[model samples]
Target: MAPEYLLWAAVLYVGAAVGSFLNVVIHRVPLGESVVKPRSRCPACRTTIAWYDNIPVLSWLALRGKCRGCGTGISGRYPFIEFITALIALVLFARLGLSIAFGVQFAFSCALIVVAYIDLDHQIIPDKISLPGIVLGLLAAIPGGMPAMTDAVLGVLLGGGLLLTVAWVYERSTGREGMGGGDVKLLAMIGAFLGWQGVLLTLLLGSLLGSAIGLVLMASQGADRKLAIPFGPFLSLGALVTLFWGHAIVRWYISYAGLAEI
Candidate 1:
């Protein structure tokens, strides 16, 4: 067997490659564009990116975050996402190795990254990612894992149902749609992978983070409390945190609240 560190390096490389692809997914999925066809090109000049220039973060850094063809400044986000993906792979590989758990969580993390960024830009969570994500999450459970199939199934139901209910309630009370259908689907997709407990945690954490940021914006820039803000990134952050340290976090919370015996 390969040394553990070597295996980790390989996983990180694979992660970087997937991150590169995810960049494409983030850009194209919301626009109803195909990710597979049409080679990566410079947006400024329509020049096809060569293999050497497409080496994920490395290529971006080497090119000084500029389009090699047009000399236009490229987004630093390209390299940042690749680095984050590599870091994620390193973490998951160190924790779960190359087993089914690692593969399943990797896919889950990739979806989160894509959906988070796309929603940040467009405020929409495309069904292309979330719906299939729901099915894949359930299927991953069928093979035996951390999240039991029952847990995954319940997570999907609870995640989607809870949000739908909230959306319904808010609309009735406020006479306006407070949340989009995309957020509901996004949470459902998260539940499919992380389970019901994860869904609960994501809701709590996402709400807290979203509200905190919203308040900060309002206080600093005169933003209205009702100003629209994206919630998917916060949910994504919560799911990722739960995936790595949820049990410990839950236990800590219970103990802190003097409910450990319960």
Candidate 2:
């Protein structure tokens, strides 16, 4: 086999293994349970899963998405998360090669995946993830060779401060909480990694996507009231888009909008 192909395969396997661990985090973090010490188990029967039966996507396929102990249905989410993680690893590898950039961005992407899924299930963005994430994101600048540290700090301030001010103004005007504190922290974390440009793009795109989806859901249900929608997933999606294509999108806009000179 080609060496390049072998390297790609290795990345996929590692990514999948990490994905499996992320599954544990997703289940345990929201519940305040320890992720370590407890081996993988069948949720239905609480039977400890053997190593052979816990091999990422393969295990799910082998068991046909059923718990071997109780024959209860297992969530398809496991394999899906694994697959997505593997794909992300491969794509990041392709885009950045086997470099520090790949490693840091890969980790950031994984955290975003965990954050997105958890927020979807619990309507929360965990402080455990986002809080440390902001700090680590700033640190990533030194080793990851990303935006300048000053830009990163500005990004954090802009991201967090912008949303906070909005939420405050919104509450004062309507006497209702318009946004969650979790989202502010989440944006701050994103800004730490991607810098101010990324912060702006994520906010704009995330808002558009969230608004469209929220409207559609409410329309489908014929509800005039605001739905209890978690905005984290849309924000995650926006961050991912910015991570991959922000520069390209910005360049395109600059050229198309006749701002190439300035």
Candidate 3:
């Protein structure tokens, strides 16, 4: 009932609204459709969604995940995305408060969410997001920003270079393309925001997470060894982890490896 609680609630509400918009981005961007012109609608029936029916998680719950006009089942992913976006916003607010840092990180996180979902659905990370993101990340790294500008520049180079090198080597060694250019750009964008150190950690974390999940899918589902899984989501997850705990993680690793003095 306190003012802080009220503030948090407002933050959550706004976050969910943003998420709703993000859902539009995720759905429409890949198809080259304008996200703003067309209002939200029930894809099943082509009926325009009413404002009340479009309320973040609540509307879906009210409608029981079905179209009000047609009773067609709506994907739960809509609400899930909304909820996750809200949670991400809350996490950022809690960590960074209402500061420039919060705004920067929130925008970065939203981009990741959009990239991740788009890649999952289409196996492609659109340049529309990552290319501009690289520029924005560098801008965010200006004085009093997340990472120092020098670090951000290095991050761009190293992030792009590291992935590119790996992708090139992988293709040459296998005589097949093993990675996409999108992954390289995505990392570069991450570097712009988090710096070269963050990029390194993000790659380590993303690769490990991707490999582990891949192995699980192969084992549990008897999936193909050559199963083509999209890597953007994993990278996004890694970036999020780094954004929140990169410093602590690095310190822990240094102590664990007895490399604190190295």
Candidate 4:
């Protein structure tokens, strides 16, 4: 009801719209297709979606999640992505207010959303997203940016290098690739925005959370240890958690370890 809440709601709505566009990029970029050349169409029938059907979450609900012409079943992922993007935008707005930091965080969040789903479905992270993201993030780290340029560069190196080294060692020892290039790039992209401390935080948090989930999955009857689980989602989760709670988490750890002056 308040003006601030209304502004946040509007931001979320815009974010949802952006998510719809991102869906196109996520689906096309990995396949070596131009995301801009063709407008959105139904995969089932190649019918160009009408403007009415393309209105983010509302259209999906209105159409009952089916193509109007071919009556094809639409994946719920469409609305789900929109909804998640909206939620993330609202949260970021609340945390950062209306500022450049909010814009940077919003862009980073959208990238993560796309990367998370693409990696989950295809087991690949497109360099198209990560490589450009690194450059953009560093450019954003001008004198007035969220982090200094020095921090941005260090973050990129630390995030990518640490993962790359571990991946190499794991592969050499086990004769299996324990990490993918995509994962390395994703971390590097995240580091560009959050800096080196964020990279370390993301790694520690992601590993702990991922290991727990893996343990739970292994205990389940239908799960196999050999089954590959995409790391992008966990990395995204870690980056998000770090974005909101990194300072507090670091302070808590230091105090718990008696390493901080009280």
Candidate 5:
């Protein structure tokens, strides 16, 4: 096997391990539980999960997605998240190679996974992740990171402020809240990492994706916009897309529009 393949495999293994920890974060953060302590256990039987049984995707397959202690069914999402996280890491590695950029973006990606899942299950994005993320994003820029320091700062302000203004306008017009604070902060954190341009692209992508999904759900279920679909997952996905393909996307849009690339 090529040395490059060996390195890629190592990254995949590390990414899956990190994803396993992310599972704990997603499950515990929203519930106000400590993710660090109280070693992983079977929720059904309260048996501590041994290290061998906790091997990311393989253990779940070996156990057939069941708790070995009590034979209780485990959600497939566990292995799914691990696999997806590994894939995302591999993609980032391929794109950015082994550098500070990869480290920053990978951490940001992991946080997004945590935020996305938590929002999906609980309709909330925890400040515990976003607030610190904002700071971290800003710091990441110091090391020749994405978009430079100035862009990152602007991303924070514009990202948070743009959504905040829309939310305010929406609430005033409808006499009801249309957006959550969590979404705003999540975008802000995205801006911190991707910069103001990223914020715009992420918003456009997220809105388009969310709107399409919303229309489908409403049509199929005979529900309305009041159905309360969580937006964090869409936004997280958009951010990931932007991180990976933002520059190419920008160039394409410019060329397609017959505008000179800036």
Candidate 6:
């Protein structure tokens, strides 16, 4: 293989390793556990995982998806997360090459991966992730950076403000908390990374995709209007889509509307 391909392969491997660590964070952070204090261990047997057994996807396959000490079935999510992280890293590398853009995109992808799973499982997005993410995103938006600072600031305001307003109105109208504070923070994080344009795109695309999923779930008797669906995952998806294809999507929409390009 070419030298560049080899380098990317190494990067992907590292990303997979990071994904394994991220799994620990995702699982423990929400439970108010220290992700750093404890080394990797099998949840079933509470046995410290040997270095070999901790290899990202390979270890899962080698162990036949079971704990070595107790033969308990391991969660498939471990390997799945590793695979997704590797794939995302490869994609970002291909798109942005070896640059700051690559780092920002990779960081965003990793955050989304953690947010997606955590929200799915617990319906919560920890301040540890979202709050730090907001600050990091803004820092990433420094002038001449991946996203301009102006854009980042606008995104932060638009994303957080819009969600906060909607949540407030919904609560007032219904006399209930309709949206979680976590959702607002998550969007703010997205805006910090993607900017105001991205914030708008994320909200638009997220709503469309979320609505479709809700409709499908309702039709299948899986969910209903009364059922609470975590909005963080859908917002993450929208942000990811915007990160990669925002410009093209915006152009296509404008052209379809018979408007001149800005």
Best by lDDT: 3
The residue-by-residue lDDT of candidate 4 on 119-143, one tens digit each, is: 8889899898899999989988988
Question: What are the lDDT scores of the predictions, listed in order?
Answer: 0.90, 0.91, 0.95, 0.89, 0.94, 0.90
User: lDDT per residue, candidate 2, 169-228, as tens digits?
Assistant: 999999999789999999999999899889999999999999999889998998867678
Model 3, range 1-262, lDDT digits (tens) per residue?
5689999999999999999999999999999999998798888899999999999999999999999999999999999989999999999999889888899899999999999999999999999999999999999888878799999999999999999999989988999998899999999999999999999999999999999999999999887889999999999999999998999999998999999777
Give the backbone clash total of model 5: 0
Candidate 1 lDDT score at position 127: 90
Clashes of each: 0, 0, 0, 0, 0, 0
Decreasing TM-score order of the candidates: 3, 1, 5, 2, 6, 4
Residue 31 miss distance in model 3 (angstroms): 0.4
> For model 1, what is the error of residue 235's alpha carbon versus the real structure, in angstroms, after optimal superposition?
1.3
Q: For model 2, name the residue pairs that clash.
A: none
Expressed as tens digits, the lDDT of each residue in 183-243 for candidate 5 is 9999999999999999999999999999999999999999775899999999999999998
lDDT of 1 at 5: 76
Worst 10 residues of 1 by lDDT: 138-147
Task: Tell me which residue pairs clash in candidate 6.
Answer: none
> What lDDT score is found at residue 79 in candidate 4?
92
TM-scores for all predictions: 0.95, 0.94, 0.96, 0.90, 0.95, 0.93
- Model 3 gets an lDDT of 0.95
On the 0 to 100 scale, the lDDT of residue 122 in model 1 is: 93
lDDT of 2 at 14: 93
Q: Global CA lDDT of candidate 5, please?
A: 0.94
Candidate 1 clashing pairs, residues 3+ apart or interchain: none
Better of 4 and 5 by lDDT: 5
